[model samples]
Target: MRDIYAGSTEVIVWLGESGPKDHLGEMILPMLTADEIASLYQWHGDRRDLPKLAAYVSKVVEDRRKTGSAQDSIDIFGAFYVLSALISGVEASGIQELRHLHKSGPILRGFDALMQPRWWSRAWVVQEVVVAQSVTIRYGKLSAPWKIFSQAASQYERARLEANADSTYPYLKEQSLARFSRMILEIETTRNDWNQAEPVGLLSLLRKFRSRSSSDERDKVFALLGLVRFWRINEKKIMPDYHIDAIKVSFETTKSLLASVGSLSVLAGTLRYSECCDSNPSWVIDWNYPPTTNEDTRLFNLPWYCAGGSDGLIELHKQRVLKIEASYLDEVISVGEELVETTITRMRPVIMDWTKLCAQFIDTRPSFEHAHYIGGGSVGDAFWRTICGNLEFVKMGVNTSNFATTTVKKGFRKATADGSLAFEQLRSADYSHRRTTSIIGGFWQESNQPDPEIARRNAFHHAVECACEGRRFFVTKTGYIGVGPRNMSVGDHAFIPHGSQVPFILRNADRLVACQGDQIETLSSATGSQPTYIPAGKHAKAPEQQKVCYEAHSELYFVIGDAYVHGVMNGEAVRLETQAFWKTTSICLI
Candidate 1:
């Protein structure tokens, strides 16, 4: 079977039973290996030739190794897994079931079953399906091209989005059905042909499938090696080293990436200390761990304003130290004792009181008085935008044309006639409510129809949902407003490290200790002071003491989180004129 698949021009898969199963006592079983059994558990129904299929694939890969080419097309025999069921002569009742509200449950269940195949979760599936020249999924006795299935899935996803935005479409509100369709659609779309002229970056490709699983942890990185564009250049260095441990692989991969790019920008993916395994270095990000929050902000291409330097450059030394060009910012004098988690409800109130929050900090730390220092108009605005989940609205100003501007202005005037309304009211609820109401009114007004109060409510709910999620905030001791991870503590220092777009949180590396009596007397003797009453022959060898060392220049620290430091955000952190004189030094991260 392996020899046949390796040399054949085409391959076929029968989703149905390939042969009769043997019954031993009361138990009926099919022959398969332990590895094969583990891999196929998620596959819903019996597939007797599953072992043969695995061998055929292995043989095909082996043949490619010897001849540089292998058969890339496969024709499946059964329609059970296919989107269309007519080929199997299974009654075409699923689609009809979707039309009736009562039958939608069974239809959704059938869709889910179709997508339950372990095939999607396999690591090898990425290379196989992506590199394939053609794939035909058979429905029972009927057949259709893979493109049809892909298009149908895509259409369903788009319809789902539309249904979510416009609540009028009841049929499209079937979330489970749409989700199942999307799962299949993504499999079709995410494939890379590898024959294209341009290729994606290794990091980008890895991030795309970071959520995928493998029985062996190392396979998470090894499986994607073939898809990496720089594999040829880095082959000798990063070749599949399954013999090594997962931690070593992670460190080596990160080191290679830093050396290749010559920048600390790669560290943007690093999460708060509380969020990651404490054993891993501050610079190393575990790609296997699923991302929790602000994933988009952590991307390589940060906004220009946030980056301290124009060029993303750094020096890699001995595979342990990173020397980057940066300006030094002020040390954190104080930080809030309480740490706020970035959960849903917690985030909402933070956004609602964004201005009041900043005011509380500004009263103590007056240095952050400058508006437009970091993209947003004011410090309050910057903090608000930083914590706001929807970057689209923050980056691009709200659309006012959709609202009745005159009406909104008049309403505000009437409400504030007594002049007792707080600024927070204008910025949070009132602002979003007015804009949302205007958009909904615009839709109805243009059509000259009665107001759709339900549509208005939906719009408002969507606005609130988008506004309150993602970032964690904190306040400093001197009344400075700092925005960072929820796990931040009182002593965490905020620094605008050079080359980075935003300020980073850092912690003290050394601890202070008190010594008394003989320990202190020994320290005094070591300083060339003779002990007045030294015992005979008791030459005091000064106790080995950890001395405090201070550098005239800057010190390196552990990066804990990103922040929006008030006064130091601009050129004040690192002097631009003397930037050339800035020495490159190694920061030892334990």
Candidate 2:
């Protein structure tokens, strides 16, 4: 049987539940090694990883029992063993700092200032120290609790020696002792308080700060302060000296948030960039170095929501960005190649009369006439904050290279391109002169290259466009159609019905109305009013209520049939349909 190490939450709760016995199991439990258990526990999972103490309390207690020789030491050690085991799980949680010896319980209580010098004098403190040191050694990381006790003991000993100095003046001696005593108390108190604070709460506070009003400078200040505290606690114990750089990155992020020049939305962009460092950033997909293609890498280009992580949307976006490199792009474009092959084989002639339909015209214009390839927004600047901060798809597009663009643009320019571009053009066109600029448009190896199947479709569309202009025929092709805010920032792409010439309609400030093949009126359109239509309207929608219907949860989707049916089935959709049609006249809905 393979041994499995519990996740963070499980580790802590396990320690609390199993106490010393589980600790023994974790140490001596054979199917896996200590290092393997540690690795498994460290990997991100459904819960937090267990701390050193909680994960190895049994080892600590057993070590004391084996080594300590004196009877009084043994008695005190026994008491220490019980208390340490009880708190091991909490220490393992890694989410909270567990420092206060006083509040810790009767067996492991705080040491008095006068009793600090002689370890033999205070049997309780000695027993607790022995257990704590043992746990720390086994765990390998020095936590806040370990530091507090260690520092307090050292300071108390030093203070006592000073008090005994013969040359020491009465007034000075008293003041020095008082100051030393106060310092020890303060450190101990702070350590306890630090441990009690929650990591989740700290993250929540940071997010809230990002969401707060930009105009409220004080709010930004308060947020920064909270972040500082969060990092400071980690500095003391949460992370080791080697990992301290992560805290520094977080601090720098706070500084950028403070200096950011835009609204709350803008500030969010600054904070987002800060999250990308090796430390706290939720996910990191190194596109430059592609790994063996797996489910993890395959979903890299999907939206963050579908990507598994602490937060769905954010994770998906991060993955898409990282996968924008050559290898990932190659994989996605290959999928597109499959799309071309499938669409070509399935192409059919139009049988419906064009003149029979009634056209309701809603005069609408494209939000932007041209797609500006804004590249390279400052990784952590205020300008990026103003525009694309909280914009989901823009983050998705920017992160994934999904939006059609060649150049990189940063800050307000990125924001402008992301939003309406109405705001951007108004400010300046010389994006080249800006502090951060990347080339706008040119060619990607996979996307720019023309495939025979894709070329045929493009030619078909061009032929149709030429006919619409040269002749009076307002011919509508069979595919999907959508209309609304027509922005990913505002609306979702809606599937239009087959053989429908439709007018664009804006549902509201946030939503778009989509008419699916003229069958139902519940589609969301703000994305585009193309000739495309989704095929699996029945499967896509629940039993009834097309408007308030079922949702698709698959990572990839497919564009099938003459009417563009884009849902859960992607490259597989093409294969499924192609294989089925050759065998039967009855079309099977996938």
Candidate 3:
């Protein structure tokens, strides 16, 4: 299918108002009413005195043409020119006015039709649209080039982002962007980026469109093989084979990715106690759904830190096992309340509770009226950096005097506070009782200057939310603070795999089976207090009567996803003073 689509000179797409149930895709030229077309052009085009709308659209089209996109297609440009004029007009007139306008009913109706179509959300559509040479979208006889839709979506995205700081810049609002059109724009960009040899990878694409629908789970992997770069696969293409089991596709993809991607950043997994998820091997990526958890910057581990350093160890075994050398960190002894509620309204109280938890271990509080991180190594600094994993602050466009950094030591280039702004509010969350004090505290008026405290708080709040999504705030036995997946247990160990960008939490897989397996016996190992397990079927003979009695101590571990432990984020694990308990060892993950 991909080869056919890729070889085609032009592909015509029947974008019906709805799915197959209405048979909109089968509509002929007569199906589109002349009145609907006229109504759309009038409401979206130059109605009267709004020259700015036309000017904005013209400028957007011109810029797109400069980028060699639909440069020769005047029809495409004209279509986009009118679409964005109205979509942007949504911001000026407000969504309520444009959405409810009787004269503009056709365009809104068109958007309504475009929103819920089955074609837009299907996983295979990614391959069809991306591989094709030229594409045209048709709603009955009313047709518009695919370039027009892509341009319109990109313009809406730009306007929506710009409107954030300026409330009056009524260009476009979020609601006006068609849901399916977003998928088109994304695939176009993916194709462009991949062709240009950008840093895009199969994992990134898989997670980006993971929500896309597909009847066969195997198609999720097969559909992407066409677009995935050969370099990411060790120059070996993953050919499709219907004979292969759907489960093996995941295992093969994971193993291939882990082998090729170098870093263990591909090792993302979860034990979703809340949902009825697949019982896949802990190392395999279940692509049918996205990762239950995300680490730094939505699973793209930021390059600022190298937690595991230069050491690299990867070993694939028979029976679906992965072994890697990791440095033992510590055990999670205490954890704060799980923050599952994701909303700005609920964020304050949730963070406040987490702050209180941090205060419990590090009782002493220092004044951070101006400084965020202490120059000397302090538990307070670790607590702050740990919770704010992947501050992602560099590109966040947040401005503050407190965005300050200093070298913690003379020869060490790494700063104590690399990329965090430890504002007074963040510092006082533990001790200050002023819950609703204005961000400036009436002090900014004295200087007659704006306060960036609100900005800092907003950024920090967002960072904490990103770092803790689908995860629980945990404190280790040695007083290290961080967030881990919800399934991280009290006795589970944290380790920084030699080549991984971030630390991870993994527990003895055999022990997990002993505790939770349907038929298993937990026994004490002959060597001290280490856990030993023996499996027995529910229908099998009694354990005493079993002929094969053997102490099973499988060193296999079920990997809990990546972590954001503060101290070890920047190669601290590699440079740690050699200790007996925190030494390196080979860990086998199942």
Q: Please, what are the lDDT tens digits per residue for candidate 2 over residues 28-63?
A: 234345664555323221123233334333555435
Cα-based lDDT for every prediction: 0.41, 0.22, 0.53
- The stretch of ten residues in a row with the least summed lDDT in candidate 2 is 325-334
TM-score of each: 0.54, 0.15, 0.66
Root-mean-square deviation of Cα positions for candidate 2 versus the true structure, in angstroms: 28.5
Best by TM-score: 3
Cα-based lDDT at residue 585, candidate 3: 84
> RMSD, each candidate, Å?
18.0, 28.5, 12.8
